[model samples]
Target: MTTVVVADDQGLVREGLELVLTARGCDVVGVAADGREAVEVVRRTLPDVVLMDVRMPVMDGIAATGEITRSGLPSRVLVLTTYDLDAYVYGALRAGADGFLLKATPPDRLVAGIDTVAAGEALLAPSLTRRLIEHHVRGPAPVVGRPAALAGLTEREHEVFLLIAQGLANDEIAEALVVSSATVKTHVNRILAKLGTRSRVELVVLAYESGAVRPGGA
Candidate 1:
């Protein structure tokens, strides 16, 4: 069973998330009412997933998520937020959150999102993903050059990364590139390896950062 820790300043929200996750066969390993405590519990429990609220006091989810990731813990964080436009969402992602989910999401989607993140995949809704892309695109470009990371990718691998950043799934990428789905998967794997990223979410970040693709720019 996947183990999860729910962290929210609101007791009711924590309890509700715990109940739903537990009913779905996820072990609710711990609960915390503040970000500091959440970070401590995550370090101790090494849970498979952390359901973190973005606006908690005493560190807040963005800082907590950063701590958890930098600690080299095995847990993946799934940020919970009531506001879709929360600025903390971008920081949390940069800090290595595996996914983000709106608190208003249905219970079933909540459970599925937990499972998805625990499995080392991101679960941002497509709309939220687009919003994140738009946000980053609107910002001034950073001075950092593309990491030497992209050096290891083959030409086809670069193509795959661009398609993924365009929000195409494996099958859709296959169709777009006129290749088989298996071939697309292989290209995706190579892209991830070359980019030194852990998930597709990071791939999206890198793609935007590298200016390989941009919001409203083809």
Candidate 2:
């Protein structure tokens, strides 16, 4: 069963999420009222996933997510917030949140999101993904350079990274490159290993932060 820690400022929200996750067969290992407490609980329990709220006292979810991710812990963070603003989405993903879903999501989808993040894949709300694409095409040219870590990637890996960074699905990437899906998957795995990212969302963040794709296309 998936193990999870629910972190939200409101007591009722915490209780509600705990109940929902529990009923879905997830092991609700712990719940915290704030980000700091959430971080502490996660470090102590080392659960598979953390359901973190964007806004909380002591430290916000973004910072807490950073703390957990940078700690080298095995836990993945899933941003479970009411807000779906671009700022929050960017902040959470850049801070290493493996998934981002609005609280208005149905319980079944929320549980599926937990499973997605637990399996080390990304789960973004459809609207959030749409917003990202819109901003990518219209947002201002951010002043940033390609990350030096990318130098470690092979030529094929770099090509794969660029495509995945633009939010293409694995099969889409394969079709674009005229390669098998398994080949694309292998390239993706190598890119992740070389870049030291845990999820594809991190890749999207890096691409945007580095201005690697630009406003038009790669």
Candidate 3:
């Protein structure tokens, strides 16, 4: 079973998620009402996925996610917020959240998202990708030239990087590059290693923030 830690300031939200997740056969290992407690629970339980809330007392979800990521824990975080356009979404992803989902998301989708992240797959939906980039990417776009972090990538890896930032699946990238999915996966792994990113969502945030990809795909 996929193990999960649910963190929300509201008690009802945590209980509801646990109920739904448990009903779906997920292992709701732990729950927390604050980011600090959430981090402690995560460190102790080391669940497969953490359902983090953006707004929390003590420490915000973004900081908690950053600490968890920098600690090199195997657990992945999937941020849950009440608003799709929450201001903290970009920060959470930059802090190593594997994906973001609104509280209104159906229980089935939420459970499926946990499974995806537990399986080491990115749960970044295309719509979330567009909204995040469009909303947060402002001021002078850095897409004009390559970001220094990407300089280490080989030509193929760079292609994969850009495609990943564009929210393309491995199969889609393979098709676009006229390569096999295995090849794409290999390229993706290399890109992730070179960029020191835990997942594609982080790379996506990197690409957008570094101006590697412009809003509106310009």
Candidate 4:
């Protein structure tokens, strides 16, 4: 079963998410009312996925996400927020969140988002991707440091990374590159392994940071 940790300040929201996810056959391992507690729970439980709310008292989701990722935890974070245009989305993404979703998202999509991130895929909505790029561009250039983690990728793997950063799904990428979906999946797997990233969301961040693909280059 896919184990999940839910962190939200609101009791109702947390409970509702837990109920919905559990009903979908996911294991709701734990829930936290604040970011700090959430981080602690994650450290102890090591759940497969974390459904994190962006706003919380004592170390908001962004900071917790950074800490969780820097600590090299096994869990993937999926950020939940009420404001679509909130600047925190970009921060959380840079902090290593695997995906961002609106709190009002439908139950089916929310469940799918969890599964997507669990499968090492990024879950940015098509509409949200454009906004995310715009948000990043409007902010500072994020220091643009190159990490040696990207050194192991092959040319085709690099191509796949660019396509993924552009928000192309596996099928679309396969069609674009004239390769089978299975081949695209293989390339993506290699990309993730070489970069030491848990999901495609991290790949997108690396792609932008490496200048392999620009924000509007999509």
Candidate 5:
């Protein structure tokens, strides 16, 4: 069974999630009332996934996510946010959260999100994609020149990276590029390695932050 830590300040939400996860056959290894406790428990339990709420006392999810990721812990984080357009949530994602889900997500999708993260795939909700494009990618940010991290990618890999940032699945990318699924997967693997990114979500963050792709631009 997938193991998880549910971290949220609301006791009722925490309890409800624990119940739902357990019913779904996941092991709720720990529950934390805030981000600091979440980090501590994660360090101790090393669960497969962390269901983290963005706002918490003592520490917010963004800081906690940074700490967890910087520590290179095995556990992947899945942020929980009430607002789809919360700018801070993007900060958390950039801090290395595997993905995010709205607090209002249905129970099945919630369970599936945890499972997806546990399986080492980034899980950006479709609505979350729109928010990122509309809120973060629509405006101009300071460009320090094309990020050096992308210099190693070949033309094909660069193309794959843009499609990934566009929220296309691997199979879809394969179809769009007229490449085999295996070829697309190889390109993705190379892209992840070259970018030093742990998942597609980080790749998306890099794409936007580096201005490799922009909203409403080719």
Candidate 6:
């Protein structure tokens, strides 16, 4: 079962989420009323996932997510937002949230999202992923050259990384590349290792940031 921490300033929402997640067989390890408390709980409990609210007292989810990720903990953060296109959602993503779910997401989807993030795969809603990509692509270009870390990836690994950043799953990437799924998985593992990224979400960020995958390119 996935282990999780629910963080929201509202007591009702936090309790409701804990109940739902528990009923779904998830171990709700902790719950917090603010980002700071959430961070502390997560650090102590070391849950597999954090159900984070975007808006909260004492640091907000974005800052808390950044702190958790930068600490190199094994936990992954899944941000919860009430808006489909909330501007803060993008900030949370950059702060290393593995994915996000709308506050109105169905119970099943919420549980599934927790599982996906815990297992180290990305869990973006398709439309939200597209919006995020567009936001990055339209931003001002980086003045510096490609990130130096990317130099370690092989040509095949680079190809796999681009497909992953485009929101394709391992199976989909395998099919598109006409390779076995195992091969695709191996490529993905190598890509992550070479990039020193803990999860696919970070890989996506690096791909776009390094210009390996552009706005309107193949």
User: Could you say which candidate leads in TM-score?
Assistant: 1
lDDT of 2 by residue, 76-167 (tens): 99998999899999998889888899999999888877886787777787668667866764656655677788878888888888887666
Candidate 4 lDDT, 70-161, residue by residue in tens: 99999999998887765776788789998888888899878878887887777786557767566566666655655676667778887888
Local accuracy of candidate 1 as per-residue lDDT tens digits, 51-142: 99989898899899999999899999999898787476678778888888888888887887787677666667656778878777678794
Full-model lDDT for every candidate? 0.82, 0.85, 0.84, 0.83, 0.85, 0.83
When superposed on Cα atoms, how far off is each prediction in RMSD? 4.6, 5.2, 4.4, 5.1, 4.5, 4.5
CA error at residue 137 for candidate 1, angstroms? 3.8
What lDDT, from 0 to 1, does candidate 5 have? 0.85
TM-score of each: 0.73, 0.70, 0.69, 0.71, 0.71, 0.69
Ten-residue stretch with the least lDDT total in model 4 = 137-146
Off by over 4 Å in 3: 135-218
Error of 6 at 196 (Å): 9.2
Candidate 3 lDDT by residue in tens digits, 128-208: 777766665754555566677788888888788888888877777899999997788788888888888887767877888
| Cα shift from native, residue 31, model 5 (Å) | 0.6
Residue-pair clash count for candidate 4: 0
Give every collision pair in model 3.
142-211, 143-211
Candidate 5 Cα outliers beyond 4 Å, as residue runs: 135-137, 140-187, 190-198, 202-218
- CA shift at 193, candidate 5, in angstroms? 5.0
Error of 1 at 164 (Å): 3.8
| Tens-digit lDDT string for candidate 6 (82-111) | 877647767887898888888888998788
